[model samples]
Target: MTRMRADLLLLLAAFIWGTAFIAQKYANDSMGPLSFVGARFLLSWIALAPLALYERGKAGCASLGKSDLGLAALIGFCLFAGAGLQQIGLVTTTATNGGFLTALYVILVPLIVWAITGARPRRIVLLAGVVSIFGAWLLAENGHLQKWTSGDALILIADIAWAAAISLVPIFLARCDRPYFLAFAQYGVVAFLGLVGGLGLESFSGEGLAAALPAILYAGLFSGGIAYTLQIVAQKYTPAAEAALIMSLESVFAALSGALLLSERLTPLALLGCGLILAGAILVEAEPALRSARMVVRRRRR
Candidate 1:
């Protein structure tokens, strides 16, 4: 797929995830976070199994070495950490706060990539990252000076896990070009971990399961099965830096979704935060063309 198409996929995934905050928050009302996460990703793993098998069959390759398993396991741990904490955070935080706070990974991704590879991103990418984080802060705080809650703190930690998971994707994908399998593998790991954690820490009931069924289906099928699969495939084509910015739009989408669906109204300051987030996304989008034009001008002078 072209980078443009890959970016569009990320954009769509952002929308799905943005709306999914509502489902996630709703699920928290009926079940413990661990139980909800277990059910969600377990369902998603099942949904993706057929597609993963089809990809393996079409490629005529299903050879996963020990290294592949190792990488997938590491990614799974990061994903499990990230997804589990974010779900737990949604229980206490507003969907808007959860959405924007979760976007902290957009800033962390570059730093993690730099730390891992020692390759600096473009100046504009750095600038976009700074702008996006500021916007996130504003959106999350809504121009108020308030102490951070446990939920907010949880999502912040989840951002670190998200950045680690995202940075590792390129490394794994370079060695193994199977997006579906990787996604499936991580989902399986998360499902297993979540289920195990839930069983040990929280009690489950048939009524809770029934109460959260709609949310489980929405979070599992659309957010996990469809959106996350799109993320893995899109990241194969899109650069990680650009992909982070594109996906960061999920914050804006989450705010809007919260407003429309949950009647979470935003103040004027919050509106400015949303606008700034879009500005950052637009700047990230324009950076490549801007650089190419500058190089063209320099060539003409030469």
Candidate 2:
């Protein structure tokens, strides 16, 4: 695909993922968090099976070892936690809040890397983190950091889990060289855990599941299969930095979709907070490009 077409595909993917927040919230109206997670991922597993299987015979696909499987399982658990908590949070939080909060994961990943590896993050990364926190504080009810609602707190915690999952997936893929299969395994792990959690902690009813079917299918099939496929394909042609910047628009789309479709309105302060958080994420993804351009300018001057 042409670069422009690839970027548009990515934009479409972001739109789909952003709007799926509505479906997730709707699912919670009838089903519990874990139940919805289980049902959603179960469908995701099925929808993705063919693609994952196709990758199984690809050249880079490697036989997984016990340690690799263990790592994949851990990543799956992290994903499960992230997705489940986000769903639970959506039950009480507006989709706009959930989307902005979830976007914090991009900034959080650098902090997570620093924590694990003791490598100092660039000043830009630190600034981005601070900006995101300030934005989150603004985004909170009453514009106070301490005044975060329970749902907001859950969404923040989910971002931590998402950061962990994001950081570890590269390691897993490096070792296994099976991106789709790892995804397959991770989805299965999430599905299994969600099912177990739903059975143990939440009441399950067929009527509830039936009521949630549209949400489940939209979140699982469209968000999972179509959007994900678009992302994978688009990334092949787009620069990584450009891809990251574009994908970050997912939060913006989420907020707009929530406001337009769900009648969720944010205060001016909250909107400012969303802008700061988005700016922080954009900075995180754009810094390398900025630095590169600066270096080129310096060389030209010399």
Candidate 3:
């Protein structure tokens, strides 16, 4: 597929993921957080089985070494932990707060990369981080940090975990070529871990299972399967900085979907937070545009 097509697919994938927060909320109502996550991952794993087989047939899955498996498992665990924590946080947090807090991962990614590899972010990224921090404060506390709730705090923690996961992806992907297989393995590990946690804490019920199945299926197929695959493809062609900017649209889409579908109202402060997040995203992605502009200027000067 062309780069343009891949980029468009990634944006659509972000929209699907943004709206998935609502579906996750609904599913959580019927099942425990871990249980709901387990169910969704189970379905996702099943759906990915065929794709994994196809990828493996061409590349030989056995070629993946011990280190690759270990890295994949770690990524899967991080994914599960982040999702599971976010689900727990949502039980007490407003959807708006959850959406805004989750987007903090974008800011955290650069910081995490800097810490891990000693690579400094560009000026725009630093500026965006400052803006995103301000936005997060507004969204979580309306500018009053003392007003923050436990749920909001939990979501913030999940945001950190997600940032780590995002930073780790480049490292893992560098070691492996089969994105589909890696994706499948990641979800499969999460499914297993989620089920173990769910069974340990809560008993499963048929009625609850039936009630949450639709939401779980939607999250698994669209959010987990297609959206994740698109992200992988898009990341391959798009620079990480640009991809992060596009993915930041998740917050905007989530807010709009929640307003339209759930009848959720955004407070003025929350809207301001959203705007700040958009500004931050633009700042984070500014390097590419600046470079392009500089190239054009040089050609014109010639």
Candidate 4:
């Protein structure tokens, strides 16, 4: 039941994230990417502040030491890098493209865990990586190697950072059980960094902000605050690989959102690419159960 609830929460997060892609894309028309990210995350921080304070009070802050603070900052930096890159990438890429490319992080998460912890990844994960790589190439390369744009490169970098962030979450959850407090720290850090970058690198008017306000609110409240918090809570119960496999559905939801809301269309080849990525995720999710069933059959035969 706990795992089932976790899965449902993850699905909800995916839905919110998928829909937010359209909001993010629309915001870019009115503001610089960094500025949009800054404004959106600031709103998230604000929305989460009261809840975070309440959680900290209930849980007590004694367990949150200097090392905990440091880890929170690290996660926050990763969040900023990943999200900032994606926001910038969305400027030149379609929302559908951004959604699918970002999902590549699902394949990369196990590798990130292996690299960080020095534990070997499962063979199944490695195989999935190979398949996912081909799918990415098909999605990004427009029949020519030279056709890949700056946007694709940016989102690819974002995928790496996002993978690292996802792998690190369970580690942080182990140390600090206060998920709301951690959310506050990460969101606050991203907001601060984004604001500095926006002020230094981009200029925008109040009118532009007003125009982007609805999208900003949706992204901030639903995607950044609610969905992300739900993910942290869900991860406490679910294993990272399974969680990632389920969350990868965000790509499908994003594609659907792009079509329904933004009228974006994918080519037949691109749809095929989406299928491959989804197939890889499904394979990864089933690998453990398949291995168990195979072991049972072999033992019976012996």
Candidate 5:
């Protein structure tokens, strides 16, 4: 695919993920957090099975190597943990708070990448991180610094987990031959974990299942299946930094959707926060200005 097409797909994935916050909010109203996550992934795994079969043929059923399996399982655990925490947080937090907190993963990813690879982050990235955090604070605290809540704390932790999972992807994908297989494996592991947790704590009821069914289908098919596939494909064509920047738009999209669909009002402070978040994202991702400055410096040196 063209770079532009890949970029668009990644953006679409962000949009789908953003809108999913609302669906999840509705689903949580009627189901236990573990139960909801388990059901979503279970349905997602089943939905993606045919695609996996097509990619690997009948041999797709074969088990992964020990190392590959372990890595995949680890990734699955991270996924499960992050989503599980976010789901639990949603029980107490507003959807707006959840969205902003989750977007912190974007800022965290660069810092984690720097730590793991021993690479220094650019000035723009540092500025972006500061701006994004300020935006998050504004959105979550409504311009107050002293009003943070427990749900916000949980979501922040989940964001760290998400950043770790995302950073680990390039490493594993570089080493593994079958990205699709690895993806499916992670889904299976998470689904199992979700189901196990759900069984122990949740009271299953027909009405509850019915209420969460739409969210399950939406998250499974669009967010889980299509969005994930797009990420894999787009990451292949785009730089990790660029992909991360595009995906960070999830926060902006989520806030907009919340205001539009859920009648969540966007106060002036919230709008300013969104602008700061966008400014941070641009600072982190844009390279043209840096290149121009470099060219001017080289000309002056000559």
Candidate 6:
């Protein structure tokens, strides 16, 4: 694909994922969070199964090795935890809040790396973390600590889980070359765990399932499968830095969708908080490029 086409594809993917936050919220109107997660991931797995088989056939592998399987399982567990918490958070919080708060995961990544490796984050990363956290407090508190809801707490935990999951990706990818099979394994594990959680914690009704079917299919097929496929293809053409910038627009789309489609409104303070969060995330993404540009300018002066 040309760079233009790839960029468009990524933009589309971001739109899909952004709208998916609303789909998740709508799904919660009828069924439990775990059930929604279970059904959607199972559907996503089924949709991707054919592609996984095709890729494996090309590689001439009948099954993944045990190490790959174990790694996928661990990654899947992290995915499940993050997704489950986000879904539950959507139950009480507006899609707007969920979107912006979840974006905090970008800020959390460096902090997570620091915690895991005992390496100190740079000044920019630390500043971003402080800014993002203050933004979150503003968004979640809405003027009073008493107004803070369970959903805010759940989403915060989900953000941490997402950060950890993303940090694990490089390690996992280094160990396993088959991205498609690894995705299949991850989805399968998430489906299995979600199903178990749903069965143990929530009751399923056919009527409720029917009501949630559209949301589930949209999230699973379009958001999970198609958007992810587009991202994989687009990343081949686009630079990682540019792609990250484009994908970060997902938060903006989510907030817009929430406002336009769901009539969700944020107070002025909350809007300011959202803006700060977006600024912090953008700084995190742009800092490396800025530093590199500065170094080149210094060399030119010399």
lDDT of 2 by residue, 69-177 (tens): 8998898899899998988887777644665577667666766766766666677766766776666556654354433478998999998897787566656755766
As for candidate 2, its clashing pairs are none
Candidate 5 TM-score, C-alpha based: 0.86
Candidate topping lDDT: 1
Query: For every model shown, what is its TM-score relative to the native structure?
Result: 0.93, 0.80, 0.87, 0.86, 0.86, 0.77
Worst 10 residues of 3 by lDDT: 139-148
Off by over 4 Å in 2: 1-14, 92-107, 136-153, 226-249, 266-271, 295-302
Q: What would the per-residue lDDT of candidate 6 be over residues 1-302, giving only the tens digit for each residue?
A: 58778778877988898889778888998899999899998998898899888887785554557876776788788889999999988888754466557766766666666676676667776676667556655654352444447897898899787777655555555565566666676678878988899989998999999999999999989886777556655656654334544565576567667778878787788677667656765665577668889999999999
Write down the worst ten-residue block by lDDT for model 5: 139-148
Show model 6 residue runs off by greater than 4 Å.
1-14, 59-64, 92-104, 117-119, 135-146, 149-152, 227-250, 266-271, 294-302
- Sorted by lDDT, highest first, which candidate order results? 1, 4, 3, 5, 2, 6
Q: What lDDT score goes with residue 122 in model 5? A: 67
* Model 3, total clashes: 0
Runs with alpha carbons beyond 4 Å of true place in candidate 3 = 1-7, 59-62, 133-149, 239-242, 267-270, 299-302
Quote the lDDT for 67 in model 2. 97
RMSD (CA, Å), candidate 2 to true, equals 4.0
Return the clash pairs for model 5, or none: none
Each prediction's Cα RMSD? 2.0, 4.0, 2.8, 3.3, 3.6, 4.3
Model 1: which ten-residue window has the lowest total lDDT? 140-149
In candidate 3, the residue pairs with backbone N, CA or C atoms under 3 Å apart (3 or more residues apart, or in different chains) clash, namely none
lDDT string, candidate 3, 1-302, tens digits: 66567668768987998889789988878888888888888888889899888988984455788998898888788889888899888888876567667777777777777887787777677677677667755664465543447888888888787777667777776777777877898889889988899989977898998999889989999998888777776666664544665677777677768779879787899779778867876664566668889999999999
Ranking 5 against 6 by TM-score, winner: 5
lDDT of 1: 0.86
Top of the candidates by TM-score: 1
Q: Which candidate, 2 or 5, would have the higher TM-score against the true structure?
A: 5
Any runs in candidate 1 off by more than 4 Å, and if so which? 60-62, 94-97, 293-302
List the candidate 5 regions with Cα displacement exceeding 4 Å.
1-4, 57-64, 145-149, 239-242, 288-302
- C-alpha lDDT values of all predictions: 0.86, 0.74, 0.77, 0.80, 0.76, 0.73
